[model samples]
Structures are given as C-alpha cells and as structure tokens.
Target: MSSNNAIVLKKYIDPTEGYPKIGEHFGLEERPFNLEATKVDEEHPLLLRNIYTSIDPYIRIRMQNPKYKSYLPSLGINQVIPNLTLAEVVKSAVPEHKTGSHVIFMSGWEEYTLVPKQAMGMVQSVNNPYNLPLMTFVGALGMPSQTAYIGLKHIGQPKAGETIYVSAASGAVGQVVGQLAKAMGLYVVGSAGSDEKIAHLKEIGYDAVFNYKKESVHEALPRVCPKGIDIYFENVGGETLDAVLLNANFHARIIFCGCISQYNNPNPYGLKNYSQILTKSIKVEGFIVMNLMPLYQEEYFREMPKLIAEGKLKYKYDVYMGLGSIPEGFLAVLQGNNFGKALSKIADE
Candidate 1:
C-alpha cells in the first residue's frame, strides 16, 4: 500500500455567501489506497495518475448543498473533489483498458485515482489525428468548444453580416463563441475585464472589444455595435446582460451560457430591461451543453478540430502547475484572476 495525496471537500459552501477562501472549504490530505487489497471479482478497475485537470465555474455550483441541486450531483463533504481530468492508466484489471494508455475521465483532485469499471464508458481515449496538445481535450476541444458550437448554431442561429455581442469574451467558452460567430460572417464585439484581454480579443479578430471594468457596457455597446446586436452570447449575467437587453435588435437571440458575474453574489441583480425581450420578440434560451451532446458531439468533434488546424479558431489557457495549485487556480477563475481557460497541470505530458 502507498500513500495517496488528494484535495478533499472540507465543507459544504453557501452560495449566498459568495466565493470561498483557500482552506476554508477545501484542503489536501494523504491516505492509504491499496488497489490490490480492495479488489472485488465482480468489479473492474484502473489506477490512474492524473496529468491535467480542469477548473471550471460549474464546479462551484456543485459545492453547495444538495437542496440546491444542479444537472450534476453535489460534492460530498470530506471526500475527494472530482474534476474532469486527463490521466495515464498505470494499472488496470479490465481487458479493454490497457496499461500505459492515456484516458480522459472524471477523477478526483489527487495525484492518483482508482476508477471503477462502471465509469469506463465515460472514459475517452485521447488517440486522434488532430495532433493537438493533450491538455486541449479538457479545454478547447472538450466542453468549452462543444458549448460554443451548440449554443451559437442551435440557439443563437447567427446570420451573415449580423452583429453578435459576447460577454466575458476572454473565457474558454466565450472566446470560442466569438470565433465561431465570426467564421459564420457575423460581426463580433467582446467585453473582457482588462486591457490585456481586450487586446487579445482584437488579435484573434473580434471586430471590436472593450474593458467592462473601465467602460460602462451600456455606453460602449451603442458605439461599437451601432446597428444593435442580433445575437448576445450571455456569459457574465448581471449588469452586462441588462445592457445587452436594452440594445438588442428585433428578433434578436440571446443564448444564456453562464452567469459568472452573479455566481458568487448573495443577491444576484435582476434584469431591469427584460421587457425588451417581449417588445423585440427576442428568443432567450438557457441551456446546458450536456443536454445537446447526443445531437452535436459528432459534429463538434469533426468541425472544431478542422477549424483549429486551419487557424480559423484560436484558444488560450491560463495553466497553473502542480496538484497543490488546484485551489488557487479554482479561486482565480471565479475571481476573474485568470486571463483564459483555467487549468492545473499536475504532471508533464
């Protein structure tokens, strides 16, 4: 038996209380985990050494009580906090999964994990022709890209020469949404938190970009998008959303991807300009990417990689090193401290 170090949930979070401080809700610990000792003949298992893990906003919603349920299950207190991870299979009892093979699955915030055979179906092999970095499987080519594709193509339904506004434009999903909209010949404007992010958006071909922290979205939107927006990719909800509603064009579409701004707020701001939805005949749809996976996963896998390879799509990552960095990395993402997709690099590829 060897000691396994893992980050465990220390307590259930109160969503109304806002973002958690380090060590307040999560902490690291070491425990003995013997794969051989715990073997049951009916169960198939694999030992995994995690290489990279994603720190996403949705995980925050799961940290709260079960009564505040989500599409996913809540994290159990004192248990290892599971995340979408890329790992190498070090040992396996199942014939289908071979040793030394790399796999992607939901694993804990640990140096190593013992995954059951029931979860094998959820595990995906990273072997592909794209020649992209493995970490991208958890970022761009993974949920974020899928999210962008499904929302924009299905809900937003953007048209050529139309205007699209994206909030939290530098985030993993927002960046992809903006790029995809532009590829469809729509004029795209993005709002980010800082000057650096604003510049990055322009470098990647956003028609216009603004710093939401400095400029009021209400004022800046009218100047940048003179024609009013045809599609608004809503990522940061609060005031930014209200401003978009005020300026939305007739028959505009609003895809409610996330509400990062209100995620931690005790009392989230209500939409004052919601009346515009009725007047403009706006189609406001809130969606979870998983709900549309069966319909769009194949299309996403085929098109997104080609777009990235052709240089039509661009992505950025704010990677923190080591397993110990997971807490701070998660906190950084929630606080807008990270510039792009937030990830923790547990080991070298």
Candidate 2:
C-alpha cells in the first residue's frame, strides 16, 4: 500500500473576511492510508480511487466555524474536506460491488477512500446507459441536476406560458433549471456574470440572457420578461433577489437554491423589495437538496438521464485537473470564474 494525496484544511476560514487564499487555509499533502486497512470486516469492505470531485459554492459555508451552523455539518480543522466524488472501486470485499465498478459517493478531497458496507447506501452506482461521459454523474446526472429538478418541480412549480428567471444561469444547477423550464414550454431568461457565459446560455436555447456585471438585474428582468417573472429560480441572492422581487408577478414562485453573492460577504446585502412577497402573494422557499433526496431519487434517476439522452437537457463542465487543483477549482467557483458545473479531475477514468 502507498500513501495517498489529499487536500486538508489548514485552518478555519473567516467568511466575513472574504474569499480564501489557496495555501493560507488549505494545503495538499500525502498521508499513509490504504483501503484495506480501514475495513471493519473483511467480508464487505470497499476501496475507492476517486476520479472526479465536485467543487460547489456551498462548501464555503462548511469552512466556517460550527457556531455559524448550517444545514450541513462544518468541516473540522486538519481534516479532509468531503464533497461529492465519482470513484472506481479498486478493491472490494463485497459481492455486489465488484472491482472497477464506478460509484458516486460523499468522499474527501483525497486520491483514495475506504468505506464499510454499512456506509454503502450512500454510494450510488454510476450507470451511464446512454454512454455519456462518466463525469456527467458529477454534474448533470448528479446532485446538481437533482437539485434543479426537485426545486423546479416541487417548489417553483412552473407552468407552460409562464416566464422563468434564473440567476447564476450558467452554473451547475442554474443551467439545468433554465433548460428544464424551456423544455416544459416556459419562457426562460438567465443572468450570468460574463459575456462568455451569457453567450453559452443563449446557444443552449435560453430565451434571453444578460451579462449581469454589465447590466443591472432590475433592468435585465423586465427587458427579457415584460409580463413579469412567474418563476424566479434564485441562485444568487442579495441584489438579484431584490430585482426579482420587483418584477415578480402575482403568486410567483421563488425557489431559493443558493446565495453565492452573500456567502462570503460579512455584511450581506439586504432586500428592499421583500414587501412584494406579501403584496403579490408570492411563494419564497429555501431548500437544501439533501432533504428531498429520498422522495425524488427514483424519479430523478429515471427522468434526468432520459432527458439528457433525448437532447432536451444539456450541461457544461468547468474541469480542473488533479487533486492538487481542488483549491483552485473551489475558489474559481466561489468567484464565478468557472462556467457551468465546477469539478476537479482527480484521476483518469
């Protein structure tokens, strides 16, 4: 057995101070660890070599102290920060999980991981029946896609002929939400920070898209959706939320998926148009995708892949190579530097 490389938290990050610098809070190191050594019982242990690891903005919340408490647990100091990862079972004591089986699981930012059979329930098999890239399991066909599906169907409840507005439109979850809205016959508009991302959204069939950095969300929403937005898939909060409230139609649905804008800001922006929620009888709800997992897992797996195969759904990947790239990838995602779903290619498939 050999030592594996991983990204370990060097110190607790202060969210109020702003974005993290690579080496100051996180560092990569090699540790003496092996899969077989972690087996609880020889009968059903699995050793996984991670291939792809996702880097999401929400992970920043976990970097904060436990006192800041979020729905998800915070990462401990000097521990390997875990994220959704796609791994190949290199060795397995279980009959059902064979060596070479690709599985997606909650694992650390490490080259390899060991899990007992009891924890196997968290491991999802990557069954790519459509021959799509295996990386899709970490993006479109993975949690982000599920987040989009559940939020839209269960929360946003969009209908055909309705107008849907998505902030962070080119991001992992936002991209899917826009595409799904379009497929369901709703008018869709998206907002991204850069011209490149805006163009990508348009090419993928968004009814309209704007470079939010160049144009105000207040101005863009009405220009794209004159009738007012019926569904606001809220990804970036703060000013965007304020604008959405101003343009929201009566009984509008706001699926609050994330708030990247306020994640790092100590003094987060306050919404002035919140009064519209009451005046318009709007439904504004915040959700974490994990809570809806059991209810939507079966349906999500059944439909999302089919949509991807049928060409009704599309996704993009912003991939960083190697485990050492984890910090860079994470920072890029927080800063909205990467387009689409951000991931790190930990190893070759």
Candidate 3:
C-alpha cells in the first residue's frame, strides 16, 4: 500500500577486517515503491510481498569485498541484500495468475519484490498439499535440505553401516544431512555449539552429539565416533576439519559445506594435518547449493515435504518477526547465536 523498507549494505566488508559491529554494516532504507501508484505489466513485473527469507552463513560470503573472485556476487554498497524467499503474489500481469498465489523466489531482503516473467526458472509456485508451515519452504524443504541431499549423495557417496560425523549438526543444513544419514542406516554422530542444540540433534536421530564449545572437537570426535568417521558432513571448518581428519577412517569422504567458524576471517585457520587426506585416501570435495539445485531441486520438493509433513523428517529454524528484525537476526546467525536456521518474517499470511 505504501513505500517499502529494504535492508541495504552500507559498506563492503573487507576480509582483512573483523566481523561487522551491530548496525554498522547494514542499514534499512525506505524506497519510493508504492504498489498503489505503480503500473503493472510484463516489463514492470509482478509485485511479490515477501513472507520469509533464508538467512545462512553463505550470506556472509556475499558481504565480503571482491578482493578475490567468488561464485556469488558480493553485495554492493547501498544495494538490498538478496536471499531465497517465500512470497505471495500481491500483483501480477499474467492472465492465469491470481493475486495471493504463493511462489518461492529470490527476493531483495525487503518487504516486496518485482520478479519478472523471465525469472520463472528461478521461481516456483508453492505446492503445499500437506498443510505444512511456509517457512519450511525457506528452511528445511528449501536450500538447507537441498544442500544436504545433493552434497551427501554426490560428494559423500555414503554406504550403509558406515559412521558419519557432522559438524554444526543442529543447524539447518546439518540437521537434514544427519537425519538422512540415519535413514540410510549409517551411525550418525554430530557436534553442536550448545547443549540445547546437541539435545535436539539426538532427538532427531543423531546417535551421538556433543557440544564442541565445551569439549574440543579433537577430543569429542574420537569419543563419540570411535568407529571413525566414514562420511564427514563438514560445516564448521578450522580445527573441526583437522579433528575429522584425525579421526576419519581410511577412504573417508568429506563433503565440504560452509565453514561458519571461519566466515569472518581474512586468513582462515590452516589445517595442520594436510597429509591425512593422502595417507587415508580421503575424498574431500566442496559444493555450492546454487550450482546443484537445478539438478536436485525437483527430487527435493517431491520427497522431502511428504517426509516432513508425515513427521518422518525433523527440521529446525528460527524466524525473527517483521522486516525490522532482519539486521539483528542476520547478525545472530553470523555469530552462531541462533539455535537454528535464522530467517526474517515479513508477511506470512
């Protein structure tokens, strides 16, 4: 009805610098977009009212200045940050499209979006036959589970009866990965940042979970996974990676997901046991969810939602209310303060 508010980057975060202070890196801007005044057409695009957006550690990578090349475009100064969002079509030009239809699309961390028809490949109409929460479209059933599905299948290549270790196992992606591993008949062990997260992971089918903050990863991994890690679902890099390497079985597979521990560092902590990969014949590989989504997304939505709705799959995320909560929510995610996947809710209904 009125002008919109969007979170904009105030400055490029240099890798040489530390984590941004609260309210220093991003600012909310009131844009001149008024749905009441604007014309709508193919070029003008359909206006979407954003409902929920996925806030992840990868968003931290987008904050960095382009001192080096990255797969994702770095957020530009004064530009609205972009994320995978679940939104409602408030206005549309298409004759077949109806107002209030929900679609999952990339939205500029704002109240509303103008997604053109050309971007249909990136947007999909919401098909929720199970009456599940829409936020799952942004969290578990969305990028997080998609990442877990692809990375575990393609990268880890896990086999039944093998032991798997997951770092940050209570986060959005890790939870899915761990649960999937359990379903495949693998013994699942994971490390979390807090006792509460560890408890959640255990309840969700993690055979073993430890608080890595209280106990060192090197100590915990060996104790929890005495069989040795055959598939390492890597999320927390740095010392955790080294610990995995130390405790990994011969020919173990390491699925390199995000390294949240080192996201803010200019110079990341280098692994000391570099030769372990060669010695153990380990397969260490990295994947970006964006690159693999096209191939696996259909499979993800087809199966994951049914499992989640049936209570066969467990997932977790924290949604901060309102557009105003974006900054604090994002910062909490970056600092590992969020219990689960952190997201911002704009207008769910």
Candidate 4:
C-alpha cells in the first residue's frame, strides 16, 4: 500500500578504533518503495519483505575504509549495510519476473529491496520449497555452502585419508566444509574460539576439535595432525593460519576463505610463518564464490538439495525474528557472537 521502513547505516565501523564505531545507528529516510503503481523502470522489480535478512562475517569487510586493494571496497559512509535476504515479488516491471515469486539477493538490510535485472544473478528463485527450508537459500543451500564447496574442491583439493583442518569450524561455512570433508572420507579436524563451538564440531563429525582461544594453535595442530596437514580450509587467519603453515605437509593446499580473525583489526598482525609457504612448497590461494559460478551452478543446485533430502548434509540456523532487529543482529554477527547461519525471520508465511 505505502512505503516500507528500512534499516540504514549512518556511519562505517572500525571495530578496534573505538566503541563508537561498532554500535552507532542513524536513520536515513522513510521513503516509498512501490514500483508498478509508480512509473516502473524496465529493469527493477518491486519486492516484498518475505524474509528480512541474515548477518554474515564477510559483511564486516565492507564496514571499514579500504586499506589494501580489496576485491570489493568497504561500505560507503551512511549506506544501507547489505546482506543476503529472501524476498517475494509483490509487483514487477520486468516481464521475466512475476508477483509471488520468492528469490534471494544481496540487496537489502532493510525490509524490501528493488532489485535490478542486471543484478539478478545475486537473486535466485526458491522453486523447491516443498523439499527445503526457504531461509536455507541464504544459508546452507546458498552462498556460504557454495563458498565452501568451491574453496574445498578447487583450492583445498582434499583427498581421502589426508588431514584437513578448518578454523572457525562451527560457523556457517566451516560447518558445511567439515561435513563435506567427512562425507568425502577425509580426516577432518577443526578449531573454534569457544568450548561450545568445539563440541558442535565434534557432533558434526570432526575427528579432532580444539578451542583455539584456550589452546595454542602451534601445539594443538601438531598434536592432531601427526603426519602434517594435507589441506587447510582457512577461515580465521591470524595465528591459526600461521600454525597451519608451519606444520603443513609438503605440497599441501590452503584455501583462503575468510580472515575473520583479522577483519576487525585496527592494526594488522604479521604472520610469523609465511616463509613456511615457500619452504614446504605449499599452494595457497584466495577465492570468492562468484569466481566459481560455473562449477557452483552445477554442484550447488544439484548436489546440495539431494544431500539434504537424503540426510547426508545437515544445516543449522540462528534466527532472530522481526524486521526491526536486523541492525542489532548484523552487529552481533560482525562481533562473532552468532553461530550457524544468522537469520532474521520477518514473516512465517
């Protein structure tokens, strides 16, 4: 009927610079978001708020001013912090789009977003609602799982019986990677920041689990991987990565997924074992999900759902209800307080 309210970010965050950086909210505007009733653009579709939002770790990268040449620069000052959201189309100007169609996108931290056709790759349809949870399109069946699928298969290239280690192993990407590695018959071990997270990793079938905050990575990794690690699914990249580098088997592969440990750093921490890369002859590579689109289109759509249906793949979600809580929930994710896929359920229907 009328315009909907959206959560707007007033300023960029610098997690270590000060407290003001992390939790300051400034509303921008309460404007109309209608499309068909108004003069509709040929490209944009008017979307409804089916599911509000989800908070993800990668979003923290966009919250700061760029230091090095990042693939995508940090978020601009006073902009809506973007995330993957599941939305229903209420009206559309594009003939290809129809009302009542549910889709996923990196468009809104707000209730409803107007997605342009050019950006449709980021927004995919949910046609198998009878088989899968709709929110999973933004979670296990979505970007996170796709990210893990690409990183492990392409970069990590794990072989059965080889040791594979994952950091932040209880979060969205880590959990999926661990499960997939186990299914492939690899020896999987992982480290998390909490005791609870370690238990969760074990429950998910990790061979060994450790709380990196309490145990030394240097000591812990060596003990678990006596034969040295064949592959590492890196997430928390600081001391943990350094430790893996030191003990990695010759020609071991390392997939640089996300550096969650250093995302909030005001000052950077230099890795002490980088020289190990050269000495051990390790192949280390960084990747983004979009780069492996062709492979993912084949794997994610076909394999992930089949695994879920057969019970080979299991997923967990941390849901926060109501649209108004989007901002707070996002902040929690950036701070590493959320486990599993952080979700905001805006509507049950």
Show where candidate 3 strays beyond 4 Å: 117-120
On lDDT, the leading prediction is: 2
Q: Can you tell me which runs of candidate 2 are displaced by over 4 Å?
A: 32-44
**What does the lDDT read for residue 211 in candidate 3?**
92
Q: Which ten residues in a row have the lowest lDDT in candidate 4?
A: 19-28
lDDT of 3 by residue, 230-344 (tens): 9999998898999889998999999998788887876889999879999999999998888888887778778888899889887777888988888888888878888877888
| Per-residue alpha-carbon lDDT of candidate 4 for residues 207-236, written as tens digits (9 for 90 to 100) | 998888888999898898888899999888
Tens digit of lDDT per residue, candidate 1, span 1-349?
Answer: 8667788888888789899767878877778877556552335477788999888888888888889868888888888888889998887787776888888888858888777668778877776687877888887887777888999999888889999999989988989988888889999999999999999999888999899889899999999999999999999899998999989999999999999888799998988999999999999999998899889877788888888877778899999898888898889989999988888898777
Clashing pairs in 1: none
Stretches of candidate 4 exceeding 4 Å from the true structure = 1-3, 14-43, 50-52, 66-68, 117-122
TM-score of each: 0.95, 0.95, 0.96, 0.90
How large is the C-alpha RMSD of every model relative to the true structure? 1.7, 1.8, 1.5, 2.6
lDDT of 2 by residue, 116-218 (tens): 6677888887788888778888878878888999999999877899999999999999899988888899999999999999889998889988999998887
Query: Could you tell me the C-alpha RMSD of candidate 3 in Å?
Result: 1.5
- lDDT rank order: 2, 1, 3, 4
lDDT of every predicted structure (CA atoms): 0.86, 0.87, 0.84, 0.76
Give the lowest summed-lDDT range of ten residues in model 3: 14-23
